[model samples]
Target: MTMRTRARTMTALLALAAMTGLAGCAPGPIVEDGPGEAGTLEVQKVNPADFAGQSLSYVYFTDGPDEAATRELIASFEEEYDVTVNLEVLPYSDLVTSVQARLSGGNAPDVVRLTGLTDFRADLLDLRTYLGEDYAEEFVDGPVKGVLGEYGEMLAVPSDLTLNGPFINVDLFNEAGVPLPDSEDPWTWDEMIDAATKVQEATDTEYAFAIDKSGHRVSTVLSQYGTALVGDDGAVLDEAKAVEALQPLVDMMADGRMPRDFWLGSGSRYEGANDIFLAQQTPVYLSGNWQVGQFADNADFTWAAAPNPCADECGGFPGGKYMGALAEGPNPALGAFFVQYMNTTKAQQKFIVAGGFLPTRVDLTERGVQYPVRQEDMDVFFADLARTPDLGYEANSQPSYTGASLELVDELALVVAGEKDTTTAVSDLKAKSEQLVEELQP
Candidate 1:
């Protein structure tokens, strides 16, 4: 398949909360804000002197049915502004199509939720003119890049940026007598291997890392090699870079750097990678900053994070998940409003404290987004995100990312089952991927 095919839905990613109800939204699954107590996202408020009267429309993906906190925010915002936002809520899957249809039909809502590049492309409002100069430059490229349309016009604003780094079980490291590195000093892949081996040997744990979900595991490895499973266009990928990124995991597993039984079917839950690190089953797990919540929730262990390992030449483990907007919305005005609203330091600070998602722009992170973990650890997570995150577009960005990444099923199974060496297996896959990218680009 071509890159275009791989560009969308990498999360399974993509979603906008509200859209014109005249049409429907994704019904595949919706995560509504549950009965988890109504909590407030600390809002960065403006002094009344600088505030203006403006009503806007907002569409959001409810954790599921309407979330009380979201509704509460809507009420609060409405009371404060001449801005009357017509709120539209919808399912995740249908969010894009429904909003596109509404905007095409001249009924687009003012603001909508967004996922990847495609959403921000096409016709979303550009925030460059609005912010002027100083404000825009403060953010890192990862968040800003996701916000653009065709011409680098700022489309949507990011509320948070998800970044990955090594989550180290300090207790395990200490027990094993392994020297823990400072967050500022990142590990190299070789150093990581030695350290992990030492940790496992001393503790008798079966793994140095766990693969609860391979999302973080795979992306960082691929970045080192210079290929990604998806391309900038959001399409299926086959590239030399991808081969480089993936080879080490195969090697690490073979060398017993990780648990032998930790492949996809190992029953490790998707959200539990953090728990694994905490339990000391693994000494190091590549994880995102959103995990600040898990760290905050855990008190028994004295764990901390280190920056993601980097190759000698290039730096940063690619990050995933930045917010954006749909080009065509039922209401462009409201869409633009949301774009501007969400990216502000105030909104991001709110997301940071509650959800543990790292604020994308340097402006917000610098101000100290809340987390219960050590100040030094939080600094490491943000540095990685700002330095390097999201090396490739998500599956939806390139439709083929999911399917193409999936194509390795047979070949990977071959290697995993011991039928092939890491070199031979990846070599064969690399040829196919290179051919595929060539076909997609032309």
Candidate 2:
């Protein structure tokens, strides 16, 4: 399709057209407008003729609607710039390690779509120099901080931002004659369970609650309790708050409000309770926004996204996929330019719609990308993302966090299995995390 034709098609796909903002990454504080407002941010333009005939290699992993959107964007880039972007797709499990190995071996691809930014920091191309300082400033500070190097270089442009939140079976709540909590007035952990219990019992559901078996998902509870695996000092978890977080999970499992088999059923390998939620066996599922597309596509029953329950505060863990160029890539100019190209206002709008993702750019966050489906669910997720505490980003940004988080899952599994008490688990986790942070220090 011609560029004009394609742009028109994308516009037709959304109920609203995102307003074009001031060009060249205008410097200013983001005006806090609701997502309903039109976005007013534009990407700093790149000269299509600058890298004409240049060839670049991009290593990527394909999943969800993003893969198609990426390929479409790339096709446009190749046509406009006369650049040949050789795309190589890999399995998500191996993408990071494979790219790291290539970087370590001094044979990195020109660009890569990465989830593990801190792991590839040394080899990541700093786009700030190429894309301009104002361009980097347009992104949300929290997600940007997660991908930046210690020297504050922009390692990647964050995309497809993901946040953890709660999903409920609306039918179950109605059947139980219980009212759902207002989004403005969120429920505490106990209050949420109390409501879920009533719903479960009234509807004859097997469980009141089910959370995905992920350290990342459980961290939402930690965040709600005002604690994180990584604190101001590296590898420090607040023991009292950490115990407070685990106690609820422990109590629910003991009382059968939550299914013990699901938590204990999956050993150390990551698992999710989405299936149970889909089967309508549970009244509530504490998962993330990534499930929205799947649920919208296949769910036979009515469901809705709800405000996350609170403890010390209400929030979810912040994380997202990122696009970056390699410092060692053969075509640094073209690679960096392509990275900048992906974050353009038009590109971001197309990406989120295709992938059912939340936008990472501040302008898009304010302007809002209207999904062709599930607009309300996306709104709840956007609000939950706003509630994410600074520590959520900080914890994920730590290089050691990946290893520490894996160990965290194992430790928490022990706590649920009665192999270790919360106090002991917290202590062991702190010690192990410290070791990991030291080992991963650059």
Candidate 3:
């Protein structure tokens, strides 16, 4: 059947399930029915024939290359299990709205992909109940720890890992006669600005660097300065540390080294720094490993990933996408099976090789990612991930800090637009973040 027809069919099925109260069915204890032992990753214990007529739905938002790889995997799964998967693909911008709308209507998909699983923990099924606790050991600690729900529930299975850093145009540095920073002895934040200024002076580029319009990217700078959004007690943003972290960005904008339009302009947040970098209007782009495939295909000039600059310490965001089954979905058993299937060693290897993502599995790391091109650039990102401090991981992983991290992005935009000075912005942000954390408390 055509994809559109399958989607329509699934929609009708979901409506039926909701009306019949099947969508709210609580899954019974998992009973292994196949030849292989239960809860073992080595064999498939769930019989395909048992779910032969079952139809499932999934929602995902991913980049071009990852999307293609997912489609291939879904096709293989459908053929093997004789089940139909109604995959609804959306842009990153629309993913949250679409999922929430479906959920409120009592028709959430059986499975969904998300970057921040903790945000939806209440609606997600605890995979540990079905997959067994031992299965969690297959993945790396950072990715696994980031997805844990309150009360220590395993809410999701990580699909791939990513590290945030900078991508520089090698050609721009060569043309400007600026020596590249040594990866072993990376440039400090001040040194990064100096190098960028030299390149802008020697070339026609409008800006020296383009930071991704994200609070998460800005948090990397905060981490380097030893300031976190949350401390042991609650939301914490030291005034001095906040200014020290934000001052350089404000200065760069005033001096035309960084564009104000990119952050405070009419453009949407999804319009990333890649545009300026690809246009050769900026010598450096601060983003993450997710851009590897896009840059390999589109960038016309010589470029490579670099270790993020440091103040007191080197840091980068340790993040990745995860797959989870919804608690209110029609079939939790099938949903859990599909989530685990996607993370199998063979499946993960194929995804990393095809999509150029860092592996989340411990064994796959030793095997190494086999990028079709630019393996050295991938190595830089891998090294950055290795050296990332514990605070960097905690900033992204902790549930209490999620709201605060998002708020920082807006406050940073205000500082860039000259609406608020760094001191006032940080002070305002601390108050707002504390309120958010209090509301989340039990």
Query: Which runs in model 2 stand beyond 4 Å of their true positions?
Result: 1-47
Give me the overall lDDT of model 3. 0.77
Model 1, position 246: C-alpha lDDT score: 55
Worst ten in a row by lDDT for model 1: 13-22
lDDT of 2 by residue, 30-126 (tens): 2212112233332234444657678999898866678899999999899876779999999999998888788778888999987767667767776
Taking all chains together, the TM-score of candidate 1 against the true structure is 0.69
Model 3, runs deviating above 4 Å: 1-49, 231-233, 267-270, 400-402
Q: Which regions of candidate 1 are displaced past 4 Å? A: 1-57, 62-75, 82-109, 123-138, 225-245, 266-272, 313-315, 318-330, 365-373, 386-414, 424-442
Better of 1 and 3 by lDDT: 3
TM-score of each model, paired residue for residue = 0.69, 0.88, 0.84
lDDT of 1: 0.54
Expressed as tens digits, the lDDT of each residue in 165-224 for candidate 3 is: 998988999999999977777789988888988998899799998888777788888887
Q: RMSD, each candidate, Å?
A: 12.9, 7.9, 8.5
Instruction: Note the Cα lDDT for every prediction shown.
Output: 0.54, 0.80, 0.77
Comparing candidate 1 with candidate 3, which one achieves the higher TM-score? 3
